[model samples]
Each structure stands twice: as structure tokens, then as C-alpha cells.
Target: MSSYADLLKTPGVARIIAAQLTARFPNGMLSLAYLLHVERATGSYGAAGLVLAATSVGQAIAGPLTSRWMGRWGMRPVLSLTLVVCVLSMAGIAFLPLEVWGYMAIGFVGGLATPPVQPAVRTIYPKMVTSRQLTPLFSLDASAQEIIWVAAPVVTTFIATQISTVLAIVVAMVFMVGGGAWFIASPEVGRVRIPRSKRAFGVVLRRPPVLLSTVVGFLLIGACAAVEAAVVATFGHGGPESGIVLAIFAIGSLAGGLALGHIPVGPWAMTRRMLIVFIGMAGVVFWLDFWWLSVWLLIAGIGIAPALAVMFAIVSSSVKFSDTAEAYGWVGTGQLIGAALGSAVAGFLIDGYGATGGYLTAAAIALLGVIVSAVFKRAHPDLRGRDASPIPDTEPVPVQPS
Candidate 1:
């Protein structure tokens, strides 16, 4: 029996995870660093909040855009090229004079160039790891991301305070470049290229759970985005407090992610609990009617990682070896679209109406995800039972190779 690490010999999975972890670790740090920079420059919480919002908006839009590159060029080219672009973008942000557009541009480039790491990672599993082992592996990956991103703030904050505000941002940039480069430098995974003209994109969409999981991911992101926007505004009351609310949510998720990974939490059992938890949290946003936004967000935030880890594990299991990137790309596309929409709507509603509007919007979308998941399950009960059967007989009628 091979050890856990031995099973992960797929060059693609290891490279992709390395790139993603490095990229996200600093990207995670950027939030706190950005918040500080904005506050210091403008001396206003509202101003900083706007900056952060723009950053979030930019990143959300980037996911699918980057995923397309992943689908077309394969992980190596996509990851490498994106890293270069991100580095330049960060440099621009660091050196350019203080202004909202400057920051937005910086954020945009970073988002646009980011590798669709999750999809790449998922794509490699069928080849790198055994079918029965997928759940635990994905769990480990998800858990790693949570830990890195969660604690990254401490280092980021310290760097920003010690060296310069821009140093933290610069470090984020450098990390992406170096790490992403390293991932692709290994020929094993990077060597596997996807031809640009491989069948129509719709072909992949035809897959059952692939499409279903992707759609679910998108709707879920929409709900979460709304929650993010609303909770920040609600607990924060204006600007300075936004960081605290985000921190609360992130910390809760950190704990949840680790538990989902290490604990023998039954995959299906945890999933059901997550679904129930999602609805309950959505309900809490309105039911409690509490002015203290922190408490509401903290209570609901614990579900974030556990829910994602479950979804990812399910997604990893759903696709064939060939369809990994495509499946993952669709998932990213869903999230990108949902998050952008959520952020835009949240901004408008919060700016005009209030926190309640944003919260209601988030809750409604989350409910829709739950409803959609149910509908999909009902519609494709065949798939609900079909993947277990052997790979549909692919043997060709007798043909002579001559």
C-alpha cells in the first residue's frame, strides 16, 4: 500500500495545489493590507470599505476569466502567464500614487491573471489519485487553503506595519510569481497540455454531475457574496468595523475547514448538515433581527469551509479524468458570475436601502441554491445512482488495426 503522499504523484495535482496555495496565501493577506492602506490614505473607514469592495469585485470576476485560460492552455501556461501578469499588476499598485482607480486596476489584473487552481487540482485527481481516495485528498487541500489564508493576515499586517504599506502587497505579488512558476517548472504536470480546439465547450456541459455541481457552486457563491457584503455593512455600521466582521467569518471558517479535513466527518452526513446549516444561517440573518451584526455573522460563518469542502469532494468524484479541468472551470465560472452579481446588487441595495436589503438578497439566493439542488436531484435521479455502475461500456465493434 502506498502512503498518502505517494498516491499524489500526479505532477498536475501537486503543481496546481502549490501554485494555488502560494497565490491565495498572499491574496488572503492583501485584504488586511489593503484595508490598512486605504484607511491610512483616506483616513476614512467608508473609503477603505469601498476600496476593499472593488478588490472583491475584481477578484470575483477574474475566476471564470482565468478558468477559460486554464481550459484552453492547460494548467502550466495558464498558471505561469497569469503569475507574470499578476506580478506586474501588483507592482503597478505598489508604485502608483494613491487613487481608487489605481487600486482597482491592480485588483483587476490580479484577478484576471489568477490561475483557476481549484479546477486544475480537481482535474489531476483521477490520474494522480485513486477513485476511493478522492474525498480525503480534496479535504486536505481545502483545509490547507483555509489555514494559510486565515493566519496569513498576521504576517501581512506585521509586514505592512514594519516595512511599508506597499511591502505587503509586493510580497503577495512575489509569492504568486515564484510559487506559480515553481508549479509549472516541473515538466510532469505542466507537460500535459489541452488542445485549444478539443470539441465544443457544450460537450462538457452535457455531463451530468459536472454541470450540476458547477451550477450549485455558482449559486452558492452568490449567496455567500451577499452574506459577505451584507454582514460587513451590518456589523461594521460604516467602514472601520468591516475588518472585524470579515475576521470573525474567516476564523470560524478556518476551524470548520480543519475539522472537515482531519475529522472522520462522514462525507454524506456532513453534507446534509451543511445544507441544513446554510438554510439556518440564511434564516438567522432575518429572524434574529439583531443590530449587532458580528454575532449573526460569526454564528453563520462556521459553515463556509465545511460546505465548500463537501462540495469540492463531491465535485472531484463526479467527473472523469478527462473532464476535470472543464468541470472545475464550470464551477469557477459559476462562482465568478454569482459573486459579481451579488456584489453589484449588494452594493446598490446597501447604498440605497440598508443592511436588511442586502441580507434578504443573500438569503433569497441561498434558498434558491438549496431549491435548485433539490430540483436537480429530482430531475437526474439516474445520475444520483448511475456513476456507481462501471464506466459505460466503451468497447468498439470489432475493428482491425491492420
Candidate 2:
């Protein structure tokens, strides 16, 4: 707690974190909003899902390219361009009376223009604080992100159900424009410059820690998405219990991150944290009651933030400053793909085997994450007693003629 407090006290730290979180809040709202809006318009979950899938695909494709572009073109221009396009696309979706294909096309375009806020903020963090503070910053960040998962859905649900789905999206757009403006105007955006990578695009994925983090993150988030779908399926009948349970889950994550963030990270740190999640989720499989599921998921939530913190720290330590943005881009992409795949698989399984199938799918994904982390323990950088800053970019001197 003292460490986190100190981190917030650092200049630019609190402001940047708050601004980015606010800007990124739409990530939490837009998914549900899109589902409801498109479903209402097209009269089919299938069509809505196609729109969502198209949007996710556009986001995935955009993450790396846009992040790298920040290095080549500069943050303000790239972010400003994306922000304007993204806003227009959301408006098009809300206002345009189009066929399902039209919605999908616009959604895909919106995704492509999704601002690379996550990667940008993360890239800037290393420059904001001391090396020792970096790990805790990442931990604080991972924990703080739970606020989005917890509140955004509730806000979106209230607006969409009580007022209108279109209004919910409009609200999201407002946050995007407002928060994006705050973040872009920050002095740090002008201060830190990501050195352009000399290597070709996608070359950063070759780093072991980046690859390890991406694979593990994919599985971890997949498990989380599975659990979310299963919970909704279990309590989707004329009640708000599902929302309450998911909020509890996010709360648990927030608590765990604050409590365990100061602990030194070792090669096995992620494995241990993930094991806590696996054990808790495994308990949910045996008992399907509402109380039992909530209890188990809350326990699983304990490991979520801490594991993510490790991923960020490991990647930061392993990549050069020039490549950090692109590396985080790939990591973000993996999580996006994981969310899409996890929900799709959980839906298929639930249709066949009931809610238990979803829980089972979640547990299976967590188990795989555990396996990957454990087998490749060497790939995770031991951050204990070491600075977790990005390696400085270097250039070779031109050879003098003999």
C-alpha cells in the first residue's frame, strides 16, 4: 500500500494512469453495448456475434501496427487519427440503418481505428518512475484495471436496459473523446519517445519472455472469459446475480494485486499465482450452486492481477526500448484473441452440456496456462533484485574506412 501510494505521488504517474483508464473504459462497455444494439436491430445473436467478431479481428490486426506507428510517426498524430476515426465509426453503427453486413463492416473499421492506448501508456511507464518502482506500477495498473471490468458493464447495462443501447454507445464515445483528449494532452506523451525499431515488424515476438507472456496471457484471459460466460448462463434468468458475482470476482482481483504486489517475482512466480486460480476454479467444477460458484471464483480472482503484473514486468525487462510498444501490442492481441476464442468455445460447450461445461472449459484453460508457465519457467525473467526497465536501444557505430 505504501509503495502504491508512493507511486501515485510520482509526477505524471497518477494522471496518466487515470486518463488511460478512463480512455480505455469503453473496452468494458462497447462489447455488451454492441451485442444488445446489433441483436435488437438484426434480430439474431448470430449476426451480433459476427459484428463483434469482426470488431475483434480489426482490433487484433490494428494493435501491433498502430503501436509501432507511434514510434515511427509519433504518438499524438497516430492517436489523434485513430480517435477521430473510431468515434465516427461508433456513430455510424449507432445512427446508420444498415444491413448486418454493413454493421460488421463498420464495426471492423472501428476496431482497426481503436486507439492503442494500453500499449502507449505501458510504454511510457518505464520513463516515468525508477526501475524498482516499475514492478509495483505494473501491479497497480493490473489491479486498477479491474475497475473497468467491474463498473463499465454495470453502467452500460443500466443505460442500455433502462434507456437505450444506442445511448450506451454514445456514452462510451463521450468517454473515448474526453479521456482520449486528457491522455493525449499529458506532458508525458510529449516527453517519452519510443525509439523506432530497426528490425522488421513481428520480429519482437522472437523474444522468449514476450512469447511466454503472450501464450500464458492468452490462456489466462481465455479462462476468465469462460468463467464469465458460464456465470451469465447460470444466473441469466430475471436477476442481477450474475453481475454481482462478476463484480465480486473483480474485487477479489483488485484486493490480491494490492496485497501481493510487493512480493519479489521469481521464475516460478506466475506459476504459483496461476495455480491458485486453477485450484479455486477447480472447486467451482465440483459444486455448481450460486454461492459455491461465487466463492470459488472470488478465490480464483486472487491470482489474476498478480499474474498479469508478472507478465508486464517480464516483458518490460526483456525487450529493448525500441521494441517495447510492439511487444506489448502482441500481448494485447493475444488477450483479445483469447477472449474471442474462450467465449466461442464456452458457448459451444454450454449449448451441449449446460453451465458446467463452461466452468470446465475455464478450468481446462487455466490448467494449460499453468502447464505452459511451469514448463517454460526459464522464459519468465526473475525480477527479484533486478531493475525491470526496458533495455536501452543501441546503435552500431559506422565502420571507419581503413
Which candidate should be chosen as best, given TM-score against the real structure?
A: 2
Name the Cα RMSD for model 2: 3.8
Q: How high is the lDDT of residue 367 in model 2?
A: 99
The alpha-carbon lDDT assigned to residue 177 of candidate 2 equals 100
Cα lDDT tens digits for candidate 1, 1-402? 143365357445655566667756775677677777767766876776676666666665565456556656566767767767767766776777767766766766666666665666555554455555555566557656765655677678778887888888877777766666665565544544433424455466666665666676676678767877786677664444655655766666665555554333342433353464465456655543443455655655566666666566555555444445655666676776787688778778888878777887777776676666666663222322222211211332121121
Per-model RMSD to reference:
6.2, 3.8
Model 2 stretches astray by more than 4 angstroms:
395-402
Q: Which 10 residues in a row give candidate 2 its minimum summed lDDT? A: 393-402
RMSD (Cα, Å) of candidate 1?
A: 6.2
TM-score of each: 0.72, 0.97
Winning model by lDDT: 2
* C-alpha lDDT values of all predictions: 0.61, 0.93
